[model samples]
Target: MGRNTRKRSKTTGGKVMAAAAALTLGAGGLVVVNVYASAHESSGGNAVKRSSQGSSQGGTGQAAASEASTIDCPDVGNGLRQVPDQARAEVDKQLALLDTQISEAYQRLRSSTRALQQDGNFANNAIMGPLKDKRVATIDRIATAMGRAGDRPQGLESLAACTLRASGNQSDTGGNQSDTGDDQNGGQAGNGPVAADFVDITTVQPNVTAPRMSQEASRGTFATQCGVNENKLYNSDNVIVAPGVDNGAHHTHDYIGNQANDAFASNDDFAAGETSCQNQGDKSSYYWPVLRLQDGTEEFDAQQQGGGAEGNTGRILTASEVTLEYVGNPGGKVVAMPKFLRIITGDAKAFTNGTANANAAWSCTGFEDRQLTDKYPVCPEGSSLVRTSKFQSCWDGQNIDSANHRSHVAFADPATGACPGGFKAIPQLVQRLVYDVDAPSLNDNGRSSPFYAVDGFPEQMHKPITDHGDFVNVFDEQLMNEMVQCINTGRQCQ
Candidate 1:
């Protein structure tokens, strides 16, 4: 698919990435009518249903127009200024229908790939083309229903345009993010050998280090019941916006355990969220950057303008599988974690800094000994590719939020995986990510082939070893206590 840059407002400060676009879309504006259709379908009936409540404000305009919103479109806001209740209802119904139709089409397309080329053509015309028109029409109806008609353009494009113009930040695009952070750096130049330049991981096996701590090196272990989080579900607003910014991660994130991922979500929210963990009492919420393929296809395609998920500029897809494992103190001694504590493991900017920041674990099925650094393995037909993230397990006795994220907690010793002398030992959390993709080869034509890289990630990611992990501890007090107990006593609890 062609890549389209999204129209973004400079006022948001953060660069316009796929995640940010998703945040904008999720914040309000255009509703994703077709994204969740399959999730709400009735097995015995053809009728589609809505899953979330209406808008939260209980008023009209874009505020009350989201698929998961609870607010009702009010009769106010003058004509064309706000979405009406009746129109909102109608648009929502159509969106649900669109979801069902598109999902069915995708399912059919997935049944075979014998004619990859022919199938691709059919997907574009028979599926994508019609879906695009329906989406555009749905946006138009929203504008017309709100009385915006000619005043506002089709899709949320109109809403975004107005927002940018009103903010007067259109000309204020001077603040480009500095390259110091991992998000900006593409890897240090002339530092070490580029992991990608190597052939397969096996060739460089001796150079790579497997990120594993033997039981003898640790006090205990915290194991997770579910090795992979495969359910097609996501909720962005559940988490808080970035530290100073109003919107959280700016993109939609797949969340498991605690459903309430929003910043404003409290310990109570964690307690109340539905969990997929074997232990229902474990209400810890795990999250990470949603992985997208180079072509912009994600596990759940939102079909928004651009590609991938809604608001994304490329075709991005969710990882084939995300393994949620509880990081237990491999030493068998566990310390309690402070409430609301947050930590990011593996550097998101590793691609820019090189191996020093790249401590993630990676391997492909069948080829075990050949560890990987920056290179991805091109597996044979029946192999599995996987990525693992091990979080820092040592924490300072005090403080949850810190100026330097790493300062609050530190990694255990590599030799023993033991907490430092004064630091507290907490359950280490690791996210083992698996994808159904392999390394790209030179023989592919037209588009990049075999090796599927993440959309928007740096070039290093294209090589495969750039895989890193990110995390936040949104576990409630009760869950943390249980983890501490299990780790401290050397008990292996799933």
Candidate 2:
């Protein structure tokens, strides 16, 4: 697939009334229509409006309103089982467009406060109705493209109509969150990481469990030293998911390992890219959403499309430490991963898509055993914040990529510690990121201590469940074979 250079521009603040319309004829003469409109700001100059019906401690009315106010649409990409090579590009493009539509609709919902307060049917009529129409059209294009080459997907229209669902930021009854905050607008961007999105680490019970290993388990570990993105390489392009589309990820990503990775990078480009690791033979690319401190600081991309313009504002936080280790599978002997293999662990839209594919694990440095998947941990005074991602360790032994970008890989079974039928055990990439920022002060809604959030799609609300990571294997063949041998032979090697 070919890609174009990234085109970025700063979006102005306040009410934006721009409407863009484009019509193009794709391969096989399919008509592709794209329409986008910015949301109107509140007349009172407030970016966000909090419900006044709640108390400081436990207010059901306000809490219900806050929790129930978010857009929920079925994930069309997950429903796809097979996409022909001829239609894969078009399908991926349409999928990315679906994500953009949802983000825009969510933005409209957030900005139109007065309309929502004045009219009961304003959201359904103005926001959701139009969003559904756009989605239906995009979904149809996907079906048509696939039908031309292979069998068309069924029941895609059922995924078009979205509904208002909970934002997954509701405060736990026993969690520490006080509504008596001075900052009313949800974070610095007026979108997310609300007071209810965090919990004290000390209160969470230990939940980490190890899978039972058998006698045939591969018991070695190969640790690769990739710096914590010290050079600050970042981009919003997702080559694995959206491929040729620029800004496919509505949020920025911190990149390490393969320096030549971008939307336009080809397989040949990655093979020839510069390396950040001390071992030049390993050139695999590792990236994830950049963590940010919502403290009113404007970084370089603050006003750009994937940054503040998309409700991802504040100062980008670089991980104090990043560990990339390929460990042996608990199931059996390991195999070398094919070059250019891609894997996406967690769901970036899990806040609305549900937690079926969510794999984010959060904890404090000392309390690593107690991991939190849905809520950010308020670490103690000295402990640092940690984000860990354990990638799928079982491969189909055939394709490097899949139609949904996930069907090609699977995680080993937890109970039996066995790979699925016809699948082979492979080295599991365990990524760990540590940050030294102070915990947010939920009592004051992060007024004194700013709330930190992982950058995500605007509609995802920056919820911790939406945290995810991306990896592309670009290791030299010799180095990859060595990694596989070390893991299978039970030898710890770097």
Alpha-carbon shift of residue 379 in model 2 (angstroms)? 1.1
lDDT of each: 0.41, 0.75
Regions of candidate 2 where Cα sits further than 4 Å from its true position: 1-67, 168-185, 444-447
- Pairs of residues at least 3 apart in sequence or in different chains that clash in candidate 2: none
Please give, for residues 354-399, the per-residue lDDT of candidate 1 as tens digits. 2333455566766655655544455566676666677788998875
Candidate 1, superposed: residue stretches over 4 Å from native: 1-199, 206-219, 226-231, 235-252, 263-268, 295-321, 327-332, 353-356, 443-451, 455-466, 474-482
Provide the global lDDT of candidate 2 against the true structure.
0.75
160 in model 1: Cα distance from truth in Å?
A: 28
Error of 2 at 134 (Å): 0.8
What TM-score do all the candidates reach, one by one? 0.51, 0.84
Q: What lDDT score goes with residue 419 in model 1?
A: 75
